[model samples]
Target: MNHQHDHSYKLLFSEPRVVRDLLTGFVKEEWIDRLDLESLEKVSSTFVTDDLRDREGDVIWRVRFGDDWVYVYLLIEFQSTVDPFMALRIMTYVGLLYQELVKQKKLTSNNKLPPVLPIVLYNGERRWNAALNVSSLVQSVPGGLEHYRPDLPYLLLDEGAIVASEQWSIETQNVVSAIFRLEHHRNLQDAIDLIGLLVHWLQAPEQTRLRRHFALWVRRILLPSWVPENEGAEWQPLNDLNEVHNMLSERAKQWPDRWKQEGIEAGRQEGIEAGRQEGIEAGRQEGRRETARNMLERTSMDDQTIADLAELDVEQIRQLRDELQSRP
Candidate 1:
């Protein structure tokens, strides 16, 4: 995982509202209805294991469930690769958390440990194939030894996988859903639209802090990734959600042309690799057509402007536009 991405996610999850919406929107369970989201509070993520080694969690929160507190151990996994032993890791972290609580005398009235809901939020492109329960990682033994095996299971929210499965909707009003949409947006237009929605949804006076966190994430992470380095270097850090939306809306007009130029350059490279004049011409024409198609699908630019930018004939752009309109 990128350090900046990890830190930005931690920043977002630091807000109680983000964590509340995260659980309410994504973690579908009947018990979620009983959670007192208003009672959600951030807790210390640092812990000392029995071995005297220090360990830190990504984010930790505790919320009221009836008369007891349910510890939410949120582990953010942003790497491209999946951790095979993640179940074991969750077991270790939860144990450390229990140990810390015991030392602090934070147990229940019965002097028993509180129940921890271990959750792993993964944003990797690959699907998670790890065991969700620690018992799965341990081999079963005969003579009833299997009864002694650990059975801790953590809830896994695989963002990319969920998006691919289309289980979540982008139209949902939840902040966490909006964040997921922005993270896995199909195109620049999708991101711009979602940012506009975020600006509108977070307009309340009390939501100012959460709004600024989104703005910072967009300014430092999303925009730099979407915009070309030369163009993005000229951009100043956005101060608020409104500024971020305005910046993206204003720069969106220029992106089609930039993408068209990039397509042409990529075509030239492909032609050079093919080492044939016919291949060069074919590659350039196909590139222009593809760029024109992208413009038609991703933007509302007029056919003439798209043709001018893609260096294609207006008739070709019009045909592409018709094809797009005809699609179901």
Candidate 2:
């Protein structure tokens, strides 16, 4: 995972609206409707372990569920490869979070730990095949020992798979969905269109912070990855959403023509190479036929023998022999 992408994702999810939309849009459990999204608040993800070591999570938020609170642990997995032990890692983090909550006396009124919804947000190209529960990674013990096994499952939201799913609609106007659409865009024009939508959707004064985060993500992460290095150097820093939209719109006018020209040149080169190969093959076949003809006319070899020597088929050798006999 690129560090810049990690930082950008963290910054985006830090906003309460993003977190709210993430759960509302992706998590499809019946209990999601019972929560109060208006009570969403960012929680400190840093925790001190028993060894006095400080560990920090990516993003954490707490929202009211009836009289209690549910902690949403957002773990952003940006690596291209899947982590097989991701379930164990989530278990460890959840335990640490519980310990911190106990220390801070943030438990429910009944003196119990609150529910923690562990979510893994993966952006890798490959589908996630890792075990969702920690118990799945452990070997089943003999007898009744299986009952003592630890169990912790996380909700996985794979960006590529989710966006490609039939259930996911591009018409969804959520900001997070817009981000995903931009990430999974087919071409430069598609990306430009999505960015334009984001510009319109977030134009309200209340969404200034989220809009700024989107602009920063485009400037720092998307632009460097999309534009060629030489051309990207000429692009000035994009401080606002409109700047990003304007720059992409202006540059996109030249892309279709350049892309078409490049494609034509590539096809021409491929045709030339293919023709060269065909000519070489034709020359080799002619040489073999000449050898077979010489053997048929100058020697008493049979069609099969001549064919074997010249690497030609017996039928072809016979045809050459017949043609030689008919010629004056």
Candidate 3:
């Protein structure tokens, strides 16, 4: 699930190609009918910027189109737990993008930039009734009658309009349903088939890599929280979770190594001469080597980079990595 996308945002914006396709149908025909591929901006995933120090935007994407070059700012944010300050959050990026467009000079002096579309895709399973806003948090009003309004619009992904669209393909439907399932599923295994199916659909280099990346990330974070102990006799879903239940077992064998490698390098640096000479050194190196071996077995990560991230010395990483090459 290593990707250049922000998962929450990707889940919010990309999976509904059904809607985007419907929305952009006009653009596909009228605007981008003959442009070179590179000039045209597109993605089935979310891209983000930190927008730190002064303020943060964490914007997913902004694509400019045509001689008019109207910018399309696709903003999506995900809420796993809960927070109420989201309106201010959206404004932060919407403003940053406006600032950038002015700096780029791509925007005309007289013309306004395209509208910023901020969509919030929430999956915490909490009953979110109130819209998130900064003014509400502050609670300001005239002393007399109390007239205050926070101008913010939210397109909830949890709502049926986005998730249950008939225009979505079967695989897209499975992934959308699976992600929403995290709000209700008893544990990670409760939704493994959909997880695996999403991996199948989105893992390919081109198909829907971004959507897949976010889906797996959401799955991983939810994986440890719960698992079904009841063993219901008829645990039937619209689909079956047990069908790809084995992937969870396989992934279990693999991901620890990824973690081990990441931790090993950190441990190596922190280890003093004593920590290294004591039994810790053996455990650190072994932890990393085994991790590299395990990750290589399951994923397509490059060997050297994996070593660096895992904090393994090049040789140990390579050695463990090389053994995987000779495997069946």
Candidate 4:
């Protein structure tokens, strides 16, 4: 994946719901059942490490499991290339995390460290061949020192490896898996149905922001090229997920027919090139604007930060803020 795509994945998974869904649905429920999902809290990704090279795409969350708390360390590997030293990398990160916990005085009276569950989320197109345990990387551990080898085993969630036969058991799991499945969708219809599935998952008022963000993703990133710029008249309030699903389904079907008619009309008018250029620019702007708007509504991000994320000017972000406020 490219930087932009990697950044988007980080943004999407940063949400606590996404993290919880991924852990509870994908990972075996034995460990997941021990976790109090409601008590899941995001921990800082940054830790005081002497090596600056440790800074990478990693997300950490703390959750109460019975009487103690456990950390869920998610290593997001976006590069198509496989890292041979992935286990070593995770071992270093987990050590740093344990240090952070100790610094925060989160250990027991006996100085026992909390458990850390390291999970690698690989969305790359290539197959992952990295060693899952640090112990496997030890080249020459003496026979007697075998017990001393660091044996950190991590859970791996390779997006490409996921199949429908291993269906997610919960609503959250289904939506989380569907989001990962979005990039690998075979056709436009599949993508639309996935969006519908996401909508179906949003059952509570607290999920309002998640629903809105998903809508923005579909509008700006997914369907901008296929859907007409002005056909909607205005962004209609989506009160029902089924309604939204039907609307998008219809739009996807209309694209081929619409493109065919537009092609013939462009041949007759000889303004195809100019129209295409204008359409591209218009779509870009609309996508950025919608992205900014969604961030403002769904996140606590400030205008300047949102501007940086959406690649819009600060003034444009401010205008989007005003427009969002003015919405009924």
Candidate 5:
């Protein structure tokens, strides 16, 4: 299946209501109070690197903060593996964004750059162990070079750490928190409970838009995992919180059997991917051996030259030549 998580996340936060909830509910109140959430504007994530390569998937916003304008740099870290150099990568992106702003004449007469609040929204299965700041990856240097090391750190919103709690603001903010909570659920029952709670929070009549958006997201990206066989057609017509609860409760009866099948299928996919990689490596090695043999038979190049050209070890090249000589 083609995973659409990158697009799903971008769409989720694209709503100004969702972004406002994120900043006001999850972020510190002091930072929230400074910004005018009403003026939060979605900016283009497409940016050209120094090498002129275009990069995408990250979300950004330009908002008015008090009397000044600031940028929000949101990096969506959805890959399975953790990147140890994430801090340095964010630094480069921030620098490039500032350069773009300057090129567009968005800077002040003194050439002062706008303040950026960098945030990472990571949802990988494994816990994040990478250093939080680029300075942490830098080797300690003398006073002369001390200023060269960067010390910026991005705020991390790890889904693994999120839980549904009273601390979250009510209504849409609570629903967003529940969405993150669903990611860390231990079993189908827990997941169902969280989904039910999310629907319940959206029961307010004024929250029709939020409910529609959340339900669409759940159906598009999340339902397949919960009900594997028919792609959850039964739950597609969900209209209210009560309907969500009833559907989930009914599916709970077959969860045990369906869950086992899904687990087996997941393992089978992993094995297939591993075997594909191994076959590619084996093919590459065999091709190199054939190249070494051809060079030995048809060319005047020595073993070292053949080895260098074919990317084979000198010893392997010699062995292949010996095997060829012994064959009639």
Candidate 6:
């Protein structure tokens, strides 16, 4: 019973356990399936980059499924739009995680490297199918691999309707429904519950909006309707919204998506920074004189000189300029 009006984007900001529950629900596997996931017992999540130097805690969820002896990364991304480097981002995270494991000696040479599964759960209204997204592929080509649901980091989580429906399971449905409400619902009460749900996940131990709504809905409506107030408890956790938020966020980082962002974005950027894959260039570094002379911007320089200075394909430069012009 989620309404479009009520939504909680900050849930990931608050609770880690609830987010874990959601991930556990979606994957239908123990939090430690991979050896490394269980052994490290860590979930690292953060923003894509520094935003005013304060992380938004937007890039949600990460975990390892194995014993402490070995584990890799299982990352989940919650985004409104598909970035071009989605796959590349996942690859970088998984690779870096292995490096972290090695640095900490949480995993050893004897331990097998775990596969990093990255799932991007999108909430934006537009369909994400595109030439770049691997969702459409049924097979992997040479050098390019296709990701399947069986993979730990597989996505497709936030088609929020089912998640928001309350009819869905604790892991997926509640989270999904809450997200859908952000884009669709309007009721203040509904909004409160969604917030409460997030707060609950955050493990806040106070009178959250859910409690408030339960108080009103039960006393004002459900009690009179002959239903018990306990029904809400079955779904909502009993704690302060803030506590729940922290708890949930902590737990979720145990998953991969969150851990990667923390490494890549540091602790400031919510998620936009997470979009930057290792190989992705965040635009170009413009230097006026590093070249043996320039061209176009300086015709005195030959094409060879211009190419040597910038080291850019002429076509690539043309595309970049065009792309910049198209930006709003």
TM-score of each: 0.79, 0.76, 0.44, 0.67, 0.67, 0.40
Model 1 residue 252 lDDT? Answer: 85
Task: List pairs with backbone clashes in candidate 4.
Answer: none
Q: Top model by TM-score, which number?
A: 1
Superposition TM-score, candidate 6 onto the true structure:
0.40
lDDT of each model, Cα atoms only? Answer: 0.82, 0.78, 0.47, 0.70, 0.70, 0.40
Give the TM-score (vs. native) of candidate 5. Answer: 0.67
lDDT of 5 by residue, 1-328 (tens): 1133546556777767677777776787476787887899998877897688876878889889766777888887778778899999998888888888878877754668888888888888677888888899999888789788889988878777565333544444454577676665555566667777766666777767666676666666665655545546678788554566677679666654443344344545555656887755665566566556555653334678668767779999889888986998
lDDT of 1 by residue, 185-260 (tens): 7767778898999898889999999899898787776775556567765656667888889888988878877788
- Model 2 scores a C-alpha lDDT of 0.78
How well is each residue in 1-328 modelled by candidate 3, as lDDT tens digits?
2223344444434434423432343232454443332433442222234644443223234344444443344433344445566667666656666766656554654576655555555544454455555455556567843455446454445433334443534533444454554344433344554566655655555555455445345444443332222322222221222232454556544554545655566546545534656546766665566556545554444666567656677777677766765788
Ranking by TM-score: 1, 2, 4, 5, 3, 6
Regions more than 4 Å wrong, model 1: 1-5, 50-53, 166-172, 259-328
Which model is ahead, 1 or 6, in terms of TM-score? 1
Clashes of each: 0, 0, 5, 0, 0, 75
In candidate 3, position 257 carries an lDDT of 50
Among all candidates shown, the one with the greatest lDDT: 1
For model 6, residues 1-328, the per-residue Cα lDDT tens digits are 2112122433332343334444544555554443232223335543232232332333434344433232323333445565655555555455555665556555534575544445555554445553333333334555545434222224455455433444533454354345445334343234444655654543344425543333332222212212123333432442344443344335323422332333334322423454654323332222211221222321222344344446656555555445544778
Output the better candidate (3/5) by TM-score: 5
Q: What is the lDDT of residue 112 in candidate 1?
A: 91
Candidate 2, residues 19-88, lDDT tens digits: the string is 8889989899999999999999999988877888776647999999999999999998778789999999
Q: In candidate 3, where is summed lDDT lowest over 10 consecutive residues?
A: 231-240
lDDT of 4 by residue, 51-75 (tens): 5655556788888988788888988
